[model samples]
Target chain A: EPEVTQTPSHQVTQMGQEVILRCVPISNHLYFYWYRQILGQKVEFLVSFYNNEISEKSEIFDDQFSVERPDGSNFTLKIRSTKLEDSAMYFCASRPDSNQPQHFGDGTRLSIL
Target chain B: AQTVTQSQPEMSVQEAETVTLSCTYDTSENNYYLFWYKQPPSRQMILVIRQEAYKQQNATENRFSVNFQKAAKSFSLKISDSQLGDTAMYFCAFMRLMNYGGSQGNLIFGKGTKLSVKP
Candidate 1:
């Protein structure tokens, strides 16, 4: 079965540096989302995208965060300045436009130093 | 706002046995969707099963089944004939049904129950 794929399975960056997490959602799906799991916390929603625009975002998705479908296939989340608390497992998910279930990727573990 | 709670932080069952993971939610909306996701050691969020709130009949997928109580706001997962492969961190999630112009379904997840299947 086709699944969402995320690049740089593990990423390490300096506290003040910028970081971009990339995801390639299922080719035919129309809705894409970003979620994060801080080491010992529940998975939290970051943002959702459709038609090259953001549908909704959470408080955690503040000024530092931005998402884009730069091209047709790639969905990227860019953090302007990575904070130490920014370390977490970032997941990308997608589903068809209807009532279909959303599927998740293996996740990219972001570590800030 | 909707919240999912998985009370059991850790549970274990012998191989070939059965185990059930409990989950409850607090929601006022009459219509929504519930899901169980498994995150193995690799930490991939894999979809396990789903139950629609409007459906009266329960949902069963092979060895995986759900005991959903709409009134009680409970959705529990029962794993029959458990295997070592079943050992994983299971999460209960909720999503309000999307209106034509609502936010794309964003899943609100629980802390997760860690199931250990001992051989």
Candidate 2:
């Protein structure tokens, strides 16, 4: 199975600091997504991007959240001024196309101290 | 709004035995997809199996298969001849088919069921 690769398997940052989580999706995939799973909680969708723009986003993707497919290969999720509650495992996923299954990355464990 | 429910929070099965994880969803869309993903201690969400609503035949991958009841809105995963490595948190998810922006694959997941394959 093709895998989505995420950078910095784990990250520790202080509250109020910004954090950037990077992902390298499968080359042939056309759509990308970002999701978060707080410890002991279900995974929640944050946003989905395609064609260099956000196609859809959940309420969790507020003003502090942003995503970019910088340089056409790297997809990044940036959280500005993180909070303690921001601590969670952020997962990146990409799909070949519509109606196809989306594959996930190993995830980046973000710990906001 | 669509929601997935995994009634069983935790289930235990002996190695070499079979265990089934329950998942029910609420959706009105006719065309959609249901999936089962396994997350081990590593936190990697691995796709186990998926079923398309249009297909009446169940989807199977080796020992992992789903009992998809579209009319009942139930999609349950049955792990046959389970192994120790099968111990993990299993999540059920739902996605609506996109008429446009198909690439924006948004998934709504269930709370998840923790499966323990005891050796």
Using all chains and alpha carbons, the TM-scores for the candidates as numbered come to 0.97, 0.97
Q: Write the per-residue lDDT of candidate 1 for residues A1-113, one digit (tens) a residue.
A: 99899998999999999999999999999999999999988899999888889988999999999999988999999998899999999999999875888989989999999
* lDDT score for candidate 2 against the true structure: 0.94
TM-score of predicted chain B, candidate 1: 0.95
The weakest ten consecutive residues by lDDT in model 1 chain A span: A96-105
Q: How well is each residue in B65-103 modelled by candidate 2, as lDDT tens digits?
A: 999999999999999999999999999999988656353
How far residue B11's Cα lies from its native spot in candidate 1, in Å, is 0.4
The regions of model 2 sitting more than 4 angstroms off are: B100-103
TM-score of chain A by itself in each prediction: 0.98, 0.98
Scored against the true structure, residue B91 in model 1 reaches a CA lDDT of: 96
C-alpha displacement of B108 in model 2, angstroms? 0.5
TM-score: model 1 vs. ground truth:
0.97
